[model samples]
Target chain A: MPKLDTAVVGLDIGGTSTRATVLTLTGQRLGSGRAGGGNPTSHGAERAAVELLTALREALSDFDPARVVAGTIGLAGAGRLLADPAGRAAFDQAWQDAGLRCPYAVHGDALVAYASGTAAPDGTVLIAGTGAITAQVRDLRLDRIADGHGWLLGDAGSGFWLGREAVRRLLADLDAGRTPGTLATAVLTELLGSAEIASRPRATVDATIQAVTRRAPVELARLAPLVVDAATHGEPVATALITEAAAHLAESVGRIRAAGAVTPVVLGGGLLTADTPLAAAVRVEIARQWPDAPLRTAGDGAAAAAWLAARDLPEVTDPAALHARLFPAP
Target chain B: MPKLDTAVVGLDIGGTSTRATVLTLTGQRLGSGRAGGGNPTSHGAERAAVELLTALREALSDFDPARVVAGTIGLAGAGRLLADPAGRAAFDQAWQDAGLRCPYAVHGDALVAYASGTAAPDGTVLIAGTGAITAQVRDLRLDRIADGHGWLLGDAGSGFWLGREAVRRLLADLDAGRTPGTLATAVLTELLGSAEIASRPRATVDATIQAVTRRAPVELARLAPLVVDAATHGEPVATALITEAAAHLAESVGRIRAAGAVTPVVLGGGLLTADTPLAAAVRVEIARQWPDAPLRTAGDGAAAAAWLAARDLPEVTDPAALHARLFPAP
Candidate 1:
């Protein structure tokens, strides 16, 4: 019989934050911890490892480290980190330093996301947060991907893409000497501040452009929420932009997804997971594209990672029952 | 009667290079000089002034500065520079330092580009070099503009756009596990050396992606010539990209152009001025869009600036004749 006090560790290393969860073998959440971004590609390997350890140690504080039976980490940019020996070593050292004695596996974020939604072994995972990418998972492993090409090259239908389109619409309106719609006005106000826009009506467009171009291009993702808000208020420009973004995301999945495959399709990232207009639009698009495939919204990735760790343990007799317990149907 | 020794000074301030010309009121190209970029928006105002002085001094070496009757400067980012007091002061200081005694007028680069191709005072000018922009000109002044939003926001059919598209095509092929065509292969070879591609067939895609993402985004413009080369060799991908670019350029002009206007349409910048496949495609698209409008390729902007300066002078009676003499119909 499995020890009643036995626990498993799961981590979700994202670009913005690292989340860790400690769960018992029977799917009871024991402790949870969060820290700053721990993705090696965004932060250096050393810093990422340090962050991972911080979150891990915090999560393990309530439960004794010795009682941890298994561990799994779902890391963004996993391929790049695995390819670098120094990065791999840093992560390995981090895992060991966290007092993790049991066997642990590191999987791509896509696979973890797929597992977070369902226990399916084969499926497609589409993510559209700061960047956009779709991956096909086979046997709980990432098989192929499309359009995660970063901001400069691709990332179409992503937050950054949506924000960029909003700015573009404002520019088009300025070029045509037309008054901007609610979305464009909101974007301008957000970027240039209301005072500047009001004080220099003629210079608002130029000021907005300079303000946007002066920052890191990825920061455009911050404007995405404004678009959603505007779309919710029945703003035509925002509505059209959301529809176009949905089409781009659907096309990205279409490029990698095998036609007529009816496996589960998991949607990840804040844009899709949240109950936003963009999420609704994407669901409609996905359903239209794959009417037969069941769509699932990902739950807490760290919890899913812990579940993945618990599923294969010999002590856990019914993995599906535990998954249901961890992530009850909404 | 106009003094035979009277000359006009013209300056073309570009982002990469600045050119200055000295021309007799009779349209004689007396002397010309070139220096580094003098665009105040790219380089700081102080540095831009220095570059302008350098080119002005060189051009004035063969002519007496006091005998220069009028001067015209066509500057990129003219709006931004004019809006800055420091920039205006710097350019004024540079003019004084260069020993130019004649009163000078500053104009936008779009006006100079339109003047370069023809003597017409009203029409449109489309430029596609490092960036893409289209402007309508009325009475030799920039009237309305479209799509000069730089690399991040717009510049849809620009060199940067072309290079980014090339990289995207290569990435797509890599994602699909398919062999890249000539254009994508050439882009990979250029970004990651030929040896790397030959040695690590499996790693080429990742390596190429890393190599690209590590650099400044604007550097992607450097790869545009390869697209032109590939298209010239009958590569389908390159051909398609070129066609798309042409459509975008045409669309930009169409946005600002009046319907059924028989005004002259001028094409400027390296991409359109050179007798390349992209240029030919643009010409075809332009012809198809506005068959009644005369299509003219731009000549040396410095000379066009000199012609503009000389045209309104008391000494020059035949401005059209001087324009023809300076541009020399091809």
Candidate 2:
């Protein structure tokens, strides 16, 4: 098949920042842009969105609209299409008609990871980042999600969860009047900057405490490896947290398999990219839990979402030629 | 000290039924009565109070008014005492004089379990009835709690959780076109009284479907044993439920122990009574989770609550002494 020139733009929205990229029908990144701020949906549905579109426009300033025929956005915490009409309108309008150029598809970031990573489109993605979400892509639709229930309630096997768990263990060590173990002391010092977390007043301590909940998904995800480091150094508490996180990821993978998904998973995001023991732990757990499942690394999820959007628009290019255009010889 | 002749009453108000017992200073069952109706608090607060008082007065008609000093009533759910002085007055006037009794406390029935089961004045109680709630009694107060987030949300280690889980597993099995496993088939048979739960009409199924959330604590609680039995009989799903339930229970227990509590634990309610393997599994998990903690059994929580109430007010002769006074000997 001849290479397609027309391209689609994909936007990856994270808690702290946003990244945008234009990919050709062959999956090559033509131009990219980045911006900052949490998702507007997390803030007020309306106001946060205005800021996002403004930011998106600024990111796409260099791109020619004629070359960009369609778009897709992989957003954090957006499980599926807005179930409620009002929410859908709000999401659509907030993007300032980013979907106006062509049919815009919005999905949870997990799908982007799967599409980009898995050699075949039918597989799963374990996204253990600043916030954790497991996305299983079966065929072309999003299917069988697990965890990602937010910070106060769930999000069991995530980077934020790991950080919080480390803090909890550290506090316990201090209260028990024992030497803070390697993991506890390291993570606690990282979170509290001292051994005085136990002595500080609740409000004061809480203020000093790191915002483990809202770390920038791509940046704060680096903490997962620190935990892995401590665990590798024989830190029992750190090992347990990482192991447990792996188990949770594995459980979600198992559910996807049980739901009739076959092997081949794409691993993506901050936690998976870290060169640490925890990532190995996750692989071991996944292998043990689903032995037949193969794993692969994923690229920028936004590009995949853009590729998907472009795939549906035959006027833009042949759908099958999207990935090759985006990542050719990259 | 001489045995006192004064008496008090204890009421256990549930969703579908209400039980009131009169105990002589020695914790002897002087008189007992029952009523059918839901908790008044669930109805209009005022209307429920009026009806509740009417029932209380009817029950107390058998007791001499002058002898009743202080009493305690255990209710369902958590909330602060209605803060409005006038509202409290109206509530007291509405429930009749029972609300005016000195130290008359309104608490969740899980407290009844905690008081009834634990040998210590303060300990933890795992209530696995229709709904599940794990309560920690510390400093004579209903201190920390976990689960009981209702059936739709949490309640991980309860019988209701187990039953609902079994149903989900069965449906998943059927959707996969696999013959239902032993555990799934048993649950389907029990829930639908048929070979397939999937075959039932949506509304008919919804109507017949035992929503574990609205279930009587006692009834939903009874499901744990079925799962345990299935596990012992070699059912994978049932065994998994018991194991998962134990893990959840241990997590709750761990949080309590981690929060600087050294109190012993009391396993209470119908779920923990002798003969069920669920109790043993829970105990093993608790032991593994909190190695040094002592665990005990609670027999007849309502009766135990009455006994503890008496123990607190020595002026009311001790329940053991009162039992001797009333019955002459064991």
Candidate 3:
């Protein structure tokens, strides 16, 4: 079962961090490394490339780079970055500097996330973290998508959407002279930095509104976890918000999914990957929509990337077994 | 009922422009002037005061300022401006420089909008222009308000809300590979500067999204009129948007309105004051909720301010009759 001195490398470039892992063809861990954000869309191409190189070098420190049979990279904003000449050049330079002789494949982050959940080549992936989007994946590539329009226009069932609804509900209660519910009170305390402000309804409402609008709109996503916490405690407002979010997310998947087809459904992103009320609610909603579909939560992305690299190698005959070894059921 | 020498001065300070009018006690217009924005919330207190003085001087150019007995100013952000010492000092200095010895009163813009519709001392005023807010007025002063939380948090049923919904629907259609409807096509032409981009669905969707997000988020309000126009031509998507907007606006009113109360209801702002489908839908919704409430559209704000100035004078015995003479029946 052991591979003789043959290894593979994988990288996951995200907006917040870059992760790299080196693994044997049999899924044994060789080395791993982490670095700052390497997404060219947020950080410039040059800096992203440099960070990518830093993570890659660290991961390959204890392994022989020459023995690597294959490599794979999962990148956010892959299309935008690869389409630009400068971005492509920076990435090429990084790969060359790593002294890797093996051929490598690059894929969109969504596809890699789908691979992280299951070995299925055709399925759907729904991500509902800070933003929300659903995509239909065929042969491990994104084929169609819905509702990834970001926080400004869409992202209907996202963390940002939940947070905004919490604040709006608080404002409505204050305006109506009714006491805010537990969830709204928690949101006010979090945003205004104190629960004492709740005594003065009018002034507190005005200050809370100002406090939220003054900052970046996306920062509202920070309150999503609080919503989940309150819902876990049986808060009605938060429970309702979670239900609505689940419905919206299910609708997004329904838009791209085939009717009466029970394909695999992979749930990614922080909201779905975590063991939260929203995750459970989404599972129920998706099951109601497609009862026969197999639901899976995404695992470690770097490990998944490594598995993808090893899957196509001549030595790895059973890709599904390799995938199961890499990401066992929780 | 002509007054020999008494006159009144009124100023309406808004975010876009400032207007001042001099009127005789008998509701006859003596002189009027207009200038740039004088809302201290947008323009600083110093510049707002300067503009106010300029408009006052121009309005009094043909009339004797000494004969003006009372003055009234309806200002946006009245509370914030008056609460700050710097803002108060600026307005005081400007008032002293204007050569008026008469006393004056300051009221929130909502009150002035209510007065523009009816002479009733108490009512509810709903505004749904670039933003949406509903207020209860008691004795011509703001009593309570609902849903003025701005674009980021609330402002449901607003122009910005309608515009955002239109863009979101277009994106949804594009993501689902469905041909966009007339309303979405019009919005695309407006944002992308041409409909030719529609030939390339994927690239055009990406470009259109980038174009809208790259600018100020509030600029989405510019697309509201397009939704209304399309709905006028019997577009289903636009008609649905208008219906939802009307429902939201009516719901906002219902939040603060007293059940079965028949006090006057004044509808202000561009969406309600104008003759449009949204206006008709809103009227129908509001009437269904409160069948006996008299619904009226707001008229010239400056004239309303002038009438407010003359409302409590010794010579003006009948204020309601004067208001009718000033605004008249539309």
Candidate 4:
């Protein structure tokens, strides 16, 4: 099979959604596509792999898929896929279906996010999305990870945790027959309804609980941004939740790092990527521990995946140009 | 509609199990039976009602259903039942099926547990079982509750919380490539078969996590006993978990109590009932806060409900004898 020297593919598979990109080896964008959640760990491996292929197919429609020289896929909970033969078969089947004869490797999302953020291969990546996890990279290999316990057990600084805390405060206020603060009021309004729940706080609390219990527990994460919005408006309870979340995230990084190492700390996930108070507080908290450490937000993971794939190629290419293209100034 | 002066019925509908008991007005136990869970909040109201009736029928098989006079039912999260029309209909259907002629009222389990434990009408009940919750009571009515947020949100100090903490420590130890402690070792053995998981710590950790993720999140409570056993064997991680659990439970009680009030503090639920270190530590913590407050363990809630029903009757009775009959030694 002859390779198309100009073509490469990159993918970022997450719990919520998956994105795929096709670009030239010389950093010219060719195609991009998106599909539903493709985290094999959250969704089944077979479904995730099919979704990944769906996105890749859409992205490679303009080019020959077989011509792509290399490809990389980053996913959370990738261990489950690797641990099962059926799961591995799903990946192979997806690759074959996409008509890709090129070589590709699957990597943990934490590693790819770190690679996307900084050129340094020995730093850390802290992600606080629906779930929270921190990983340490020593010379580009993931050395250790901490606190990605999912919503049921841990994910201390994650969206689910914050939202759950907000509802708990609201319920407590309702039980105590006290007027809810700005944070609780906003949370209840979003959870129950606009007008009917306004007067009956206890009923609102009951309905909120009933709703969450009847649905998926992960759906509670949807309420997290409202909490952030309340905090931005100076709600003390919301502010306290943000402070605690930052502390938890910082603690996760501290648990993996040694004393006085000037490692680059890369932040990823929607909570940190948004220009919000929680994001700013997390940055401040990280700086408190490593006074001189550089902080960076991750570029598009799909682009980083391409860079990862292209890094092993036998040609010299400008990595900085790819970074500039993927993460253009806003 | 004739009431049986000699017979009274009581029922406890819970998330995991439903129990019913028939007793004479003088506290002579006639029959008792247990069936599947009947918590309308966890299971839908229709199923809960059916299960409740099934338990009652089994207990009442030896007696006339119409003879079950002055019945009382204790249900957890009963508000959900009250709010839904179909749920209310299920309750009505069960009542009609049972042929009850006497007055009956459904009360929250927290209130019934308080009545079961102490002679005083105003006090508190701290329950730490599959879940953890504390309620303040005044004159037999529930005043307020704390920390009953279910496994997904709160329930801090619960069996699920302890189990979750154990697995977390196990994962951390596995990630750090450290030797398994007593707690981790026991948890792995229970989650995976002992013979297969004994040697490979990393595989065991992965298997443990994979197994938990596949099941209902609340099933984490099944692992709590292993942690308690490890703590008893002096594993530092397990010991720390139990201590934290005690602190959380005590804090819940503190949230509801008044300063310098000599109110009784009743303890309920399996974790507190068992002669474990958690229960002992909770007693010590409670004593520290309320030096003069009496500490009591609740008798069977079904018996308490029956007693509550019988208390209003014109016939005088020996309360001490009834308590002794319900919670006999061993």
Best by TM-score: 3
Q: List the residue pairs that clash in candidate 1.
A: none
Q: Rank the candidates by lDDT, best first.
A: 3, 1, 4, 2
Which CAPRI category fits model 3?
medium
Kindly list the per-residue Cα lDDT of model 2 for residues A75-179, writing each as its tens digit: 765642355466567767855554335556777777777777643667778777766656567775666555454443245577766765665555444423456
How far in Å is the alpha carbon of A58 misplaced in model 4? 7.7
Candidate 1 lDDT by residue in tens digits, A1-330? 455679999999988899999998988788888999988887988999999999999998877887899989999878788889999899889888988888888888988888999888789999989899999888788887888888888888999999999998888777666677788888888887762343334366567779998899999999999998899888999999999999989988887788888999999888999988898999999999899999999888999899889888899898888888888899
lDDT of each: 0.87, 0.61, 0.89, 0.81
Angstrom error at residue A241, model 2: 1.5
Q: Which candidate model has the greater lDDT, 1 or 3? A: 3
Q: Which window of ten consecutive residues has the lowest lDDT sum in model 4 chain B?
A: B195-204
Q: Count clashes in each candidate, considering only residues at least 3 apart in sequence or on different chains.
A: 0, 14, 0, 0
Fnat per predicted structure, each in turn: 0.62, 0.00, 0.81, 0.31
Could you arrange the candidates by TM-score from highest to lowest?
3, 1, 4, 2
Off by over 4 Å in 1: A1-3, A35-37, A43-62, A79-100, A195-202, B45-54, B80-99, B195-202
Model 4 C-alpha lDDT per residue in residues A1-330, reported as the tens digit of each score: 133346778999987789998977676788998999988866899899889889999999999886788898888876667788999898989988999998788888888898888767689899999889888899877777777867765688899989888888777676555677888878877877652453644456557788778878888899999988988988899999999999988877877776677988999999997788889999999888898898988778888888778767776256656566666645
Report the lDDT of model 2 for residue A167: 54
For candidate 2, report its TM-score. Answer: 0.63
lDDT of 2 by residue, B1-330 (tens): 233456676677666666666676755676665666435556444554554565566656766645666666666642423544554565567454653344555666777766655445577877665566676677556766655544433456777767656655654454334577887666666655665544432232332344433454334445555677798886878877878887876665665456545577777656566656678889898777666667766545345545555656757434445433432321
Q: List the residue pairs that clash in candidate 4.
A: none
Ten-residue stretch with the least lDDT total in model 2 chain A: A200-209
